[model samples]
Target: MRRHKEHSRRLPAGPRQTGPRALSGRLPGAVAVVAAAALALAGCSGSSSSSSSASATGSPQASGSPQVSGSPQASPTPGQQNGGTQLQDAYQTVIANVLPSVVQITTGESLGSGIVYDDKGDIVTNAHVVGTATTFTVTLANSTTALDATLVGSYPDSDLAVIKLSSPPSGLKPASFGDSSKVQLGQITLAMGSPLGLTSSVTQGIVSAVGRTVTEPQGPGSPGATIGNMVQTSAAINPGNSGGALTNLDSQVIGINTLAATEPQTNGAAAPGIGFAIPASTITNIANQLIKQGKVTNSGRAALGVTARTSFNQQFQPAGAVIVSVTPGGAAASAGLQAGDVITKIDDTQVDSLNALTTALASLTPGRNVTVTYTRGGTTKTVDVSLGELGTP
Candidate 1:
């Protein structure tokens, strides 16, 4: 389907269409955000709202008449009384409890979703949803009033960010966060957000997978990075759904919807029933830091300390990572590494390309030291460097 972000910051291409990496639909004319996993993914920008069509009741009703059921109704069947009524009631209760916390975010020609993060007027959304703006216009659930908000901070590596309302809305209810560690496959979920600018919309599905090491392009024309321990779901994550809540039946925010599947080989056909989100455990930690410091000082994420790109050998096979620039006082710089060096491996893991390098590094935490193998001037070299923390204001 057609996805477009007509008036916002640049939209990144989602994962490669080969299912090795997928992009999500973002722009009014593009697919979702960039994604990786041998699984194609993208940022929200598609128009399809996924919902199971309700089956017809198969009974006729009187037109323009209030049918009063004064007569005693038949008791439900044993199966219906035990399973159907309980599930239906549970879903209704959760939806009612959670809808008030979801909100719509608009920034320069693009629209997306967010969730109320706290009673202090803080809101959590995707870094891309926050875009490059420090101020925003947010529409709360079931309300048309657009309130002013200020950006607290954003961390794109995990696709999470925080914004605060200028004036706290009275009776604001924050959604509770569930332990992502407790999330399991096949659990039911409700994806809430504004898709195509429709406020307070929801789609239902089940957890398709958990703890996936998924990566996406930071944005258009930037080096891609992984958002570790992702939550994959079958809920329809459409355009503008980014930063919205992937909630469990307990009305808890389990994840923040971020990416949708797109098949580029089919001219960017949206792959229904597949979407991704940033887990709540990561969201809580990053948001807390951003709100307090306006930047993350201890990201817990591993970084290479140098800008790098993939390079190939003479045989056109993936060889290693080529360093472009090293951060001053960073692990690579302290280790005396410089530009023009090709990294071939990290510890025992072979680094064949940029993606491989990202995967290897994501497996480690910040401050962890590992041996990096590289080739410079046709001479092989190794250096022990402590990985640095990523994330700036």
Candidate 2:
């Protein structure tokens, strides 16, 4: 498994630290701050003496009446209109439209939520969410009925998977996809999922950063690799949120909430406000492929069994996959690549770090010949190597 070093930074913990809570359709933290300031100015006017008398007189009986004679008064509360039920109305609207399409996914021993991609009942989630699941159960958001779902396809390297339900529930409203490429930093974002098995939890935050490359957990047959071009946000994401959607204010999903930074500090304390997600642009391509094909089709390229060190000067920076040994008769061996060689690039792309190389390789397919450039004996050399299918070892 990938071992991520948690960086310690103190930030405000989310309300009710048990995990993220269900949305009450109120303004997010940032928005609430602005709204509160506006309310302060409005409160300065104070209730007019005439308005106070009306309220104390016959208006009390009419206040509970559904029909009002005069123009409907504006809501006194910032988010409440006419009465305090407006917030609940908005919450119901969101829950009604989006909840049906969300499904609780159980794969292997892992469980996470997924959003329906299309009318065909195909559900998309993180590959890690369904990793190696021999069987799957999909539960609708509003109902307790669990339908059997079939594993359509999965790309572990990219951390994406698709499943098709044999009998999906009615009234499924697919989530609208948004452009991740246009997502701006500091824009408000929402995350909806079952964090710690609490269903329908919603958290809010702004886009923290973008283009982050996180290394996947180490697994059999493949070393830890980087997931490139991720969208980082301050939205709280927990274990069960791996496959949940990260949406914008309009409720259009822009990213798939996946990873979070939970590094312990040197003082042995956990930090907050660090989370990550897979961009929707990447999710769309991979999910479409999984729905059509059972597996991802890779352009074949040569395999060089080598790990990399982060820096040449440092004898011990276990960052990249260093070449401990070369597979005999493999592409790297045929290209005169030796065990001591340190790979620094693939084709023209610089790979000074292992994460960079892993990200580059993840974008390429097997059987395609690419230039393998490396440094050996303090000399850099380029060699043409044919790609091979992973797991051939």
Candidate 3:
């Protein structure tokens, strides 16, 4: 099997036993792309093909002086060399325009990459990259001076974070965000990050899948899961590649690399490829909320504590969430949901699985009332339940 190589490095321990297994018994394609995207953002070694030649020139405006135009430089530096002279020139032009907006992010013991999103130096990165970090540092591309950064907001549920720099460098260029909803399978994509701490790594691949959901384990013993819409790609990802940019051919960011699947082995071992990235739509929603509020809180309908089981009866089987327990003043309790009842639907959405219930509640806010249909003693009943905030259980 041609598996993407895993770049050896240290990373914060991920939740155990999470992520989807590869269908081909190889590394999951999603895992490979996400890891590669993260690594590229973190600055790993990879290949690049040049297609454009444009130069950007500017100097800081004099104090109270008006902006002025200057001729563009026509030559590439020795460090800017690509495969061919012309290609190198084009690569340099693109790099010069894009590099300043990219940043090296260091949070706690975790290191990754991020992109500036606004002129105020607001940077966006994976939440896991800066998870609970007490301090953060941002290194501008082509410069070694590290700027102190503050964690402005974070949405752990969506795996997104935003940080602000104290004093941003001049000519800061924010990356252009694209519509991830339009991304299609087999579309070519590019990833940028620092993999294994190699600054400015870039890789290329195609979108392997879209609208895929992966569940990341929250903790070793915690029964919680982090589920999000993901964009799967075959791009190579490695350690330290977290929070990198996944862009389309137009160079617009469409996703944020997050987690990758490890190779399956008999004797506990780590394998390569199999990467995943949070889709840009989710990122934009979570990021906007993070920017407005310090945290992203979901105001969704409540669920009674339950775990359902599916069993076939002859030629048919009924699936639904079975109530295993009821919280002492929960909306379900107030709505007359009993311990033996099976939830069948919420509003117009069918609830055949726990995943379905969770997803259905995503569009609702807490304190909203909705009708729930259930089954008890082979009889169906409908009741009104007021929604509640998550974590109430």
Candidate 4:
């Protein structure tokens, strides 16, 4: 049972991996714009026949004063002129209202962002941001004071954590979190964080899509959680943006900026205008649990309730996930799946490894009946298994 490594499976047609890079060490500053090397503007030079016709029609008045197609118009109407100004004003107002609720989280070697949860000094952030450090240096937006904070709890499976300030500062503004269920596509969103250590930085974009399942690549300080129902945005999510606030036009935090897709062709460079965020509902659910109990008691994610590892064939090539153990009365056990069973598929998706199994389960909910294909002894078998709710790690 070797550790499950990320096998480079061929992605469909667009962006490949949506892994959130660890912002603790040397991270990419910004999304590099790869401009087209050359613009070949192929023009149809006037043919001899067309030029002869134009010449016969009298060259001076041939085109009837040249028929200016796109002439500049008059000044815009009052409403039209003020439209952009009004939008700019809205942006400024939202920033002024919510920026103070966003804080810069700095550990010994990493930097990230957090949203002030409540006046009790609890702040919600990405678990990857906290990493293994329990203590952190937090700086409020537009404030020079560095405050000491301690970790309350971290739910790495959901990539969320809560921290408490040592000394609760007065005038701590808690951000208003909107209902993620109500977050619609095409809605304007603003991502606020300390990208590249630039504190109080903001990037704007529209909600490109909703209900996306994204998986971060496994790395040191990151569990590579496969997140579901994530809000996809065109916002530029760079390093240090993780765990930051993704807010709507109403000045409400709708999501926590988490993973950004990387261009596989460019050796994992950050793909601009494509990012995923943990919805506000999940943040609140996990944050509340962590703050109250110091750990997540119930994770809504589905699980097969089996301890497994990546299995390989005699040729040493990757095969399927092999069940090493099964929880008593768990989903796998209830379905009569025992140790030595090698899972090859879940429903329709192929399970080539343990990582693939986890990813397959991430998209499903508990209590759903699904077909599981596996190999036991020398025979391949399929069983209907009821998924169980994943427990906290």
Top candidate when judged by lDDT against the true structure: 4
What TM-score do all the candidates reach, one by one? 0.77, 0.64, 0.60, 0.81
Expressed as tens digits, the lDDT of each residue in 1-393 for candidate 4 is 222121111111264544534332344343221111111212324465466656655545553464322234434668887998999999999999899999999887678899999999999998888888899989999798999999999988888899999998899999999998899989999999988788899999999999887777664456777788899999888788888999998999999988887776777776678888999988999999999999997778899999999999899977899999999989999999999999999999999988889889988999999999999887999999999988675
Residue-level lDDT of model 1, residues 269-336, one tens digit each, is 66788788888988898999999988887777898788888989999998999999989998899998
Model 1 scores a C-alpha lDDT of 0.81
What TM value does model 2 have?
Answer: 0.64
**Which scores better on TM-score, 3 or 4?**
4
**Where is the poorest 10-residue window by lDDT in model 1?**
47-56
Global lDDT scores for all candidate models? 0.81, 0.68, 0.67, 0.84
- Over all chains combined, what TM-score does candidate 3 have? 0.60
Ranking by lDDT: 4, 1, 2, 3
Off by over 4 Å in 2: 1-96, 219-223, 266-270, 298-340, 345-353, 359-373, 382-393
Instruction: Give residue 79's error in model 3 in angstroms.
Output: 30
Indicate whether candidate 1 or candidate 3 has the larger TM-score: 1
